[model samples]
Target: MLKTIFPAALILCLSAPVLRAQDLPDYVGSGQCAACHEAESQSWQGSHHQLAWTEPTADTVVADFDGTRFQNDDLTVAFSKDAAGYHAQITESDGTTTMRRVHSVAGIEPLQQYLFETEPGRLQSFDVVWDSEEKRWYHLYPDQSLPVGDGLHWAGPYKNWNARCAECHATGYEKNYDPATRSYASTQAEIGVGCEACHGPGSAHIDWAETGKPVEIPGVDAFGLTMRSTADSEGWIQQCAGCHSRREAFGDGNPVPGTPYHDAYRLMMLTPDLYFPDGQIREEVYVYGSFLQSKMYANGVSCMNCHNPHTAQLVAEGNAVCTQCHSEAGNTEFPSLPIADYDTPEHHFHEPGSEGAQCKNCHMPTQTYMGVDARADHSFRIPRPDLTPITGAPDACTNCHQDQTPEWAAQQIEAWYPDSDKRGPHFGTVFAQSAVDPAGALPDLLKIAGDEGQSDIARATAMYLMGAAADQQTARATAPLLRDDSPLLRAAAIRPQRAAPPQEQFQNLLDLLSDPIRLVRLSAAPDLLRAPVASLPPRIAERFGRVAGEWQRSLGNRLDFPETHLVLGGTALTMRNTPAAIGAFREAVTQDPQLLDAWVMLVRLEASVNGAEAANAVVEEALQANPGQPDLMAMQRELQQ
Candidate 1:
């Protein structure tokens, strides 16, 4: 029998009645393993993974509840603890002070967020947060006073714990959302990320440990879990990207541990929405996408090499973690890495033991999100200070030396190493120039997209930008990528065929309708929708309609955000369902009143369906909120005439 160490605190937290895997379902609670795998379980005790989310008990609750009132802009929130539980008095956008009970606590250390169940299975994390280190309550968006009905509001869908946060925070979490009913029957085997969250369902593994019988579940590994599915480094990294990367999931999204990333979720590329042109972290990209761009990733580096997965901590603290592999003599594991004194002033250009001497300071720059959450970029690119003014991407040099300009930083680097290959023209400058004038940068983008020497992700992103102002040349540049093995490139190639005739585009994109990846199939939907359906063979048209329906359903499933509804409205227009388009546009403006495009579409729809009078009313309404808007003003003049 494996001796398991169960701390008194861990035992108390695990006292809740759970749905045992053997009795009712697949997930055995994490607590069930304490008697067997003691060391691993004990090692995980009090880890960030273990405490990501917890029931708001006295010991677990780190915030002060001594009737403290914190004011953020116009709103004043009062936190108090009663006999029943911890509660907050929050003033709504409509000026109603409502009492909300704290249902659960999320995060620890620098900050802690409280979850409130506004409705059954519709839990929302209140915007007001407790800064544990500061010992004070502060709004998550201290500077921005978002109104109550806004999606970014604490009570709105964006902050909903089930859809946004639950998947990663808990084990065996089934969102179980019903789009038809607008409700959630959300269930989790154990609250907070647990043993099964990473290792997969533990019933067969536990049985094997106790009875010395290996469960012969097909596809199950020797540990009796569906893990270690592939021996390659990329396959293992997919296990981490499932949660770590910002992505869109397909189907039920109940991905088993080690499920192939494409089989489970569509990993987002370096889209302009998430990252800067240079592939530096510009938003709340957790880490995976940035890490994929690193030279380290190219040379066979992995998360497990530097961090312990169980404890969720660095394997070694400070610079020592990096020195293990990046020593003076490049190890056999990384024969390509040149021999260099990484720790000395020769490489770092900083005094030994200074903040700038840290490997991460020079390589992995930091970007802050969610107010207090500062995460370091994992791309590990050498700082190109020269690209700062050109591309608007932050460089590591100016990040530390706030007063100095990027020009000065670049000059200093050139001064330090006159012949250093690190200081060279980079993709950042190209991406920045492309964003400003896509026509001007088309040649560079084409070169980057076709070159195998460049990062495939950067290549794919260039193809994505190619969709704007695409010509015959752009089509020629991207046509071959449709059959590329990488789905990212395959999906991106479909968008840049503007000059090609509709039939030609349909012909090029037809086979991708049957592409194995859901994202690839979905990407082909719009172009296929333009097919001469009446002229196609009966069987081909049927298949086309089927794929189109699947793509529409995929769009419908993600109507939680205004962005999705915006897409829904555009798709509806393409399908020639004017009423559906109108409804979707209305929903979008309801979520975000300032969405000028939605309002413009509404005006266009009203003019077509009803009359100029109806269109004029919408235009006037848009101008009231967004006065002097050129598009609306133009419409108003046309309607008046």
Candidate 2:
């Protein structure tokens, strides 16, 4: 059964417009840009961005496809190339063998993942990937033995190319999902991340070039470009962060190239799931969130300062990257940087050529992801072994010295730099302490939230945690932040107020419905759902309705995601629509059987509305899907009783 929860009218209104090649009229493609910019085109020829996604071809496909068999647990995939194309013969544990043609190849250097079309218009990234460096095949998740129906399976909802990856990997992409049919007719102007991905559509630029490069125009931009290179440091950083950061999209597909970061997406803060309490990269969070915590970002440094935007490589190799600004001959671009010798043995307290003396080894430690890809932390933090014991966060010092305790590392650091002012109160201590003693941590959290010196992301994180104990004190502390200049802070301030009274929620959040930033309006709209719209002024009621519609449209855009169905189920329950709620929850569990909460909700609704027989059936199905799960087992026992 296709459990389509959304109404036909709503889906039609909110669905992404069907965008084909002709629909993207302004997009002249990357080849158009190459005619005028030869140097940049040459640099980007084989760069990671250019090869992010490509059609599988002889030159493009680097994996061994000459009848090679790779085994992982009970699954064996035979790779071979025929006259037709690259093919994978996957043998499942249940003794079913399926032949799938390779539809596309993703990435290049460290690891390359192959995509296979599982169903019509649905491409799934295969779990088995090619390790380019070692020239071998390996499973991305080696430990897990996922069944065909599992959410984490290669062909499951979570690994769907249209929903999860297409926008980032391709240029001018649109995920045209039809909820009625639950299928994708996804389209992209270019196959891989191209010159137009960063610079916006190139038709106007080409026109400007052919017309003798006019200095001024009545309606067109000076250069006929959408995104200007003359933007400030923060502008440039946000442009890159649009794709690099871990974030939630506002609507279907990617936003236009020049859209402000907050307007297009909501950035994930320093949450424990994605980051260590001290704001170190704990997962594959890319670089934006960590970089936001750095002194380099605070001091007006951007991605182009250290990395060549064309090649996606560091401007200088090794310690020379840091010495560009940190050395005695400081960089002219950043005159505010103090001239200092940081690349010597005296500063590092290690042999000049040793690993310990490397700037990145101490400050920007690397964490491996995707089996073979090693990504570095971009926080550019000074080593602080002293706080590791208190915050339970990893320190760079003890990371290299596995045998030594954090206390031992702290003592060594103290001996080397006894008068270090860097050893001060850290937000990580407050965040860690909040887990065991939230009451004790509240005052410190309040202080951190209001601290101007702290990074905006860190401050926003502090505000988000205080929502767990949303009391009068928390409400009062966060009230001022609602008016903060930063959209991140303003959006985060809405979270702690979720527990406030209906009237309070109305009074506090009504103004934010019309906030200039889309993220802030989206954050505030849900909490204001309980507002007294009926008795309110006509203008106020209209404002609430408009913002609520925006929120629903945002939800509609991501209906392809199973987690979005969970949100829909909850929202339906809040509206007292039992049947709609049941339908949404059923859809959620149907799409991804591992959603325990959705199953529980569906069972409870069925019991209340349809009787114990229906509820018991749901329980049995959940138990079958998630075998021996304690919560589901308990539910099954309860149903049997």
Candidate 3:
């Protein structure tokens, strides 16, 4: 949703840097690099990186923005030419200053960014992104209806790059926006993610090359020329992960490429906002967070391993890319007998050339985010048709055939994969059904929790669902995962046993009190309080008290905007902070009143504290927001009964 643009004079008009006899870093822009590295540059130029941000000139702008007026709701938005460049006049539902300058255009066919000058040299993200293929301008946050003058409206502070986007989009960018002075000064080494971004700063490397002197560079080859990502040298991989991850930036962009990931960006742990009860992509957690949870990343695979960094092309053609790792004779280290005729109807049960046969169409399914941009999940998961009916996640079959049901997909899968026992049951399916039929799935969920063969994500999911199961066996099964290296897995482990021995649970949660993941640390907070205070380690109890105090200080801060509050709230509840838990639920409702969990939690909180009358009012408001939600209707029936 972040849109970036360098000053036109600063971008297209800048003189190309002179390359000396010494091979300088590929600063000649991707075009000049294309001369010798033709194949690589060609692929790079066609990639999302090359087109990340572009000018809307006739040569670059593929969409029909020329005098086009797209109407939405009661508004008429028209893009036309001006002396400065292109401009748009949006006449909204209520009449106001209907014109704004279009400082930059984001993309071509798929999505277009409209830029607004917030301050001198400061451009912010706009909620309205034009989908050229669809030929419409839809809201980026389609779930919420913004008031005309609200800050979250198309023109708002939350969407601005100074706070939200500068770190990722531009190279060596600094976000130095001072609220008190109402002044701003930020710098980018080059607009868009330039060569130096992944390569690290070229000053030292360029100097070493010119002088013909040896220099040390962290996570680089001996020649100081290339990045190294041998399992032993994954430090460089963390550099690429900075922008690619779903994480929070620490300090003011001080951490450079060689800096450890934990030092610069705190990776997000699995939360319900960015994922379902099962670890499937929900909101845009970016690639790194979800990808790290994959068997691929854990087994030494990397982003550049599949994607050609220079050209941005797949290493091999289409499904062939997958064959390198998942071959007939699988890689010796992680062996699995490849199923025969995987490319044919015998395996996929679809026509050979159809999209259904594509490996990514099933495993790396696309989640259309930012309205127009469809980000394919990099997590290579087996398609789970059974989860489709319970959770609203799109199954591979229904994704292709929208009119078909999950039952239809399940039937088709059974027809081809006749031996259903070959494929394992889905964690998503088990968790979804547990919300309704806890008794039936409780034993299976416990088995999944302790199944070392299952994915860590699947195991974590099993642990989380077992909280509602309220069984001693499930609690015992999940205890070991609290020590998991992945904070996501650890956070999930905390959920199942809130009512257990306070001393053991408190000691276990205490060790992770300072966990690098925000969600993990957040989760530990409520559990510390829920435990008998005396049972907690004195140091951990103090830390929990401090974190709670900080949460109180930032009481008005809405976790809902980040879309990770559901997970954060769950963590807070586990720790036993009713006010923070209530606030989180309140923010969720404020953002989207139709969220049934928010209503249900709010009602539960009210019933636990104030009484049934207060709980009923919250439920009434939720019903008004979403009249047809069966879950809310069921909750209402339970309360009355």
Q: Pick the candidate with the highest lDDT.
A: 2
- Give each prediction's root-mean-square deviation over alpha carbons: 8.8, 3.3, 10.1
Query: Model 3: which ten-residue window has the lowest total lDDT?
Result: 1-10
**lDDT of each prediction vs. the true structure?**
0.77, 0.84, 0.62
What are the per-residue Cα lDDT tens digits for candidate 1 across 1-641?
00011111211111122222233226888888888878989988888889999999898899998788987566888889978999999886568898989999998867899999998878999888888877877777777767766556777777888878888888877676665466888888888888888777888787778888757776567667766534467776777787888888654334677667775666677767789988998888888888878888878888888888778899998998888877786577878877766878878889899999999998888888777778999998888897888888888999999999999999998898889887666777778777778888888888888877777678878887765667887886688999998887888788786557766777888899789887788788766665554456667666776666666555544555566667767766765668778988987777666688999999999999999999999998887767698988998999999
User: Once model 3 is optimally superposed onto the true structure by TM-score, how far is the C-alpha of residue 118 displaced, in angstroms?
Assistant: 3.0
lDDT by residue (tens digit), candidate 2, 1-641: 00122233332235433223233327878888887999999999999999999999998999999999999677999999988999999998778899999999999989999999888888899999999999999999889988889988888998999999989999988888888888989888898999988877777677778886753523235676556656787878988998899999876776767668998899998888888888888999989999999999988999998999899899999999889899999988878998889999879998898999999999999989998999999999998888888877889988889999989999998998899888898999898877778777888888998999999999999988885676776876688899999999999988877666657766888789889999999998766654444466668667766776677778888888888888778766665678778888888888899999999998899889988889899898898999999987887778788
Clashing pairs in 3: 43-311, 44-311, 106-113, 526-574, 526-575, 526-576, 527-574, 527-575
Going through the candidates in the order shown, the clash numbers are 1, 0, 8
- Model 3 Cα lDDT, one tens digit per residue, 557-589: 222132444544564565465766786677666
Shift in Å, residue 498, candidate 1? 4.1
The better-scoring model by lDDT among 2 and 3 is: 2
Q: What alpha-carbon RMSD in Å does predicted model 2 have with respect to the real structure?
A: 3.3
| TM-score of candidate 1 to 2 decimals | 0.90
